[model samples]
Target chain A: MLVYLIRRIGQSIMVVAVMATLVFLAVFAVGDPVAILASPDADQRELEAITTRLGLDRPIYEQFGIFVWNALQGDLGRSFVYAQPAVDVILQRFPATMELALAALILSILLGVPLGVIAGLKPESLLGRSIMTTSIFGFSLPNFWLGLMLILLFAVQLRWLPASGRGETVEVFGVHLSLFTWDGLRHLFLPALTLSLYKASLVIRIAQAGTREVMLQDYVRFARAKGLSYNRIVFVHVLKNMMIPVVTVLGLELGSMIAFAVVTETVFAYPGMGKLLIDSINRLDRPVIVAYLMLTVVIFVIINLVVDLLYAAIDPRVRLTESKG
Target chain B: MSKAVLDVKDLSVSFRTREGLVTAVNSISFSVGAGEVLGLVGESGSGKSVTGLAVLGLIDPPGEIDPRSSIKINERELIGLPEEKLRRVRGKDVAMIFQDPMTTLNPVLRIDTQMIEAIRAHEKISEKAARERARQALEKVGIPSADERLKAYPGQFSGGMRQRVAIATALLNRPTVLVADEPTTALDVTIQAQILSEVQQLCSETGTALVWITHDLSVVAGLADRVAVMYAGRIVEEGPVSAVLEAPIHPYAAGLIGSVPSRNKRGVPLAQIRGMTPSLTNLPPGCPFAPRCDYATDICRSTMPEPTPYEGGRAARCHHPLSAPTPAAA
Candidate 1:
């Protein structure tokens, strides 16, 4: 187990390194950040001084080497747009995005899995067919469009909830949480609900397919023959067996939720990392762009690692097979 | 008979499929007594497995057990029984062992966890007690190092070994009836014989009534106290193992026994039944086997044959019963 963890961590490090190199190259390939930073009225010498100060005058490889060195020390350079450390700027916005993503994920799972299980158990029933049919809308409708529609319905027409922003927040253990308070949750509900609709449907399909397949397995029949209650059989035996596919999808989906939250964030005017990313992109803030790219890569790698580890814990087939190697 | 462990009468199973309602097991009836082994022999679609599943009340919806049918394990009626009572009766009063031991055991669970859960499912026992019983059950099935084997997952065990574990799990609760649906069909020949003998011995020793469902006549000849031959969802012939094997009255049973390779003269081609097993869907009106029988007559084609008694607790479902022949003389 220790060896497997070490091997996984080693692979993750390699993936992060490759991603970092690519992001660095792409950031440099685009027009230099010096153009956006220097004033048009400045003379050539003043522009040269600014370029030298930002180390843009150095050779690309030398600049990259220094970037790597400073990155190792947790410095992803300073954002010219914010005039602050890029990592710090990203960190400041990360909590809101994390809160939203986590809520969306929770909503998706809580709603989708049970609905999927029901649909799978009775795939031919009227309710099952309707659930499945309704899930298609989740797939067909874009999150941005869905977000707008939800805002128009609940916020515009009904006025049941607020339309935009992160609203009020309380600090606990130096972390901003938008959960529990009425104002915070009211602000959060529409965005989270809109984001979850598509993924929840995806989860429903995955869970349905998985449940259907696993139900046919001989072990499930054995469990039934063993006289286990339906609840026990479904929850303990079938649920665990089905989780392998669901968890894999969930891991990939979560990483995607964080990275691709741009549209939803923009739609709601939610001040999140995705919003920060958009502003940085328009300004050609190279440090922020590269940092965001690297951060996303790190998150993807970590999530994948966690999912693989969870496989071993949830399914002994994976764990036993790994131990043999 | 010592005591009837399981009593099933007029049990018919039908499935509501997209094409139509297909009968899988039709008006089948059989019983097992304590320490008695009943071999349910048939071809692939002979409803032998369905019979076993139906006996355990494990048949799900879209595949319905006929409401008129009765399945009583230890005088506790299974038909129309609520799920709660049915569950208690299942692993405690009767248990089922399935084909493909590789699939019968959950791939993700440890042997001990599965076994203990099986034991605890019926009885309220401590995990320690359940584990001890599981260990003993494994050892009973000839698995070595029972304690260590308990910790191993199902995938770690080979095919034969896994089957043994499955058998052990079935026997963990020491239920009165064990309905094994071709449990060793997927095993190596040598391993098949070993498992057959071990299961036979275990059932006798524990007084657990056994319904060993299989397609192999040789296995039934070796293992079962009585043999019931099924064809197209019905029991065509049933009797003591020697009586049925030696003098099968039904033509289908006779055709089955004749096809056994060992019975034919050396260098001669093996005897085979003339036609394929008919499809269960859209079965012809009268006797299902009449089209395939050599001696099928007008009466055979127009009317289903009821089971007629012959001798020595034997019965065969046939319009024109075949002449009884002794195995040694043949």
Candidate 2:
């Protein structure tokens, strides 16, 4: 087990290195760094000074080395647009996006899995067919479109929820709290819901497929023959076996949630890392962009690792063999 | 006679498909007495497995049981019983082991967890007690180091070992009726014989009514007390094992017995059943096997025969059974 852990950690470093290199190359390949550093109106000497100051005048390899070194030392450089530390800016906005993604993931599993199980357990029944049809439509609908629909229906039509922003105000212990604390959660709802709808549909489809596959497996038939209740067979035997593939899809979907949240955040006027990343891109905020890309990559890797751990937990076969090796 | 352990009367099952409602198991009537091994033999798609599944009320959606069909265990009707009650009856009163041990045991779970769950489902017992009983059951099925093996997953065991685990699980509850659906088909001949002997011993010791469903007539001839031969969703021939094997009256049954390789002499070619079993979706108006029967006459093609008794508790469903020819020296 210790050997396996060390091997996995070694592999992770190589993976991160590759990820960093690719991200660096892709970002730089789009345009000349000198052009961004120096505008046409700038004097030649001043342009050269700016290029040198920003390290653009240095060799690409040297610049990359410095960037990697600084990143490892927890310095993400200064934001090109905001003139603040890129790490600080990204960290500040990350919580909102994290909360949204987490909520969306939790909600999706809670709702989608049971729905999928029900549909799979009785594929030809009326309720099962209806769930199948609706989930298909749900999966096909665009996240942005679904977001707008939710906002239009709940915010514009019903006037129940605030259309935008986290909240109007906050209160604790019957005392009014500050805007920063109060407004965050109020604004989080619509955006989270918008993101969750599409995610839930994807999860439902995956779970449904996995459940159906597991249901047809011999063990499930054996469980049935043992006189296990339909509910027990479906939930205990079928659902547990089906989770491996569902977890894989869910892990990938969780990573994509941040990418998908950009559109959703934009639609809701929510301040999340997705929106921050997009704004950084539009403004050519190189430091902020680099910071966001690396953070996203790290999160993706972590989610996959966590999913692997979960696979081990849920399946003893994986655990035993993996431990042995 | 001892009370019938299982009484299946006029049971029919059909599946709803785009083409039409296709009957998989026609009206089949049979009963198993206590401690009797009633072998249900048939080729693929003969509805033997379907019949076993139907008895357990395990048929899922797309398949529906005909309301007219009734299955009684110990004189209590099992058809249309609430799922909760059926679950209680399953494993406890009646249990079934399926073919393919790898597929039969949940791969993700340990044998202990699965067996304990089965034991606790019908009985209120501590996990410790259940585990102990599970170990005993595994030992009874002849698994090596049974206690250690309970912690192992289904994949860790070989095909024969897994089937033994499955059989152990089925017998864990000491069910009165045990239905093994082609349990040995997935095994090699040596392991098959071993498991068969183990099952026969277990059945006689417990006096459990064993329903051994298989396509192998030879296996059933040795293992079963009585035999029922099914063809195209109906029982065509049934009698004592010796009677059915030695003097099969149904043409399909005769063909089946003749097709067994061991029965063929070295100099002569083996007898073969020509043509495939008809699709359930497009069954003929009369006998489902008529098109495949060499002795199929115009009347045989137009009308199906019901189970008609011959002497010695034997029955056959054929208008013209082949008369006994001069016996060849063994």
The global C-alpha lDDT for each of the candidates, from Candidate 1 onward, is 0.90, 0.84
Interface RMSD, candidates in the order listed: 1.0, 1.5
The DockQ value obtained for model 1 is: 0.74
DockQ of each: 0.74, 0.64
Q: For residue A148, what is the lDDT in candidate 2?
A: 83
- Which digits, one per residue and each the tens of the lDDT, describe model 2 over residues A1-325? 5676677677777888898888887887666545665577888888788778777788889989999999899897888767789988988776667777877788788878989877876777899899888987777888778878887888889987777754544545553323245456556767777787776777777787888888788888788777776777767888788878878888988998965578888888777788898887776678888888888878787777778778878887877787767
What count of clashes does model 1 give?
Answer: 0
| Tens digit of per-residue lDDT, candidate 1, span A185-254 | 9999999998899889999999999999999999999988888888988988888888789899989999
Q: How many Å off is the CA of A53 in candidate 1? A: 3.5
- Winning model by lDDT: 1
Tens digits of lDDT, candidate 1, B164-278:
9988988888889999998888999999989999998998899999999988898999889999999999999989999888878898998998998983489999999988899
Model 1 — TM-score against the truth? 0.93
Residue A108 lDDT in candidate 2: 83
Error of 2 at B253 (Å): 2.2
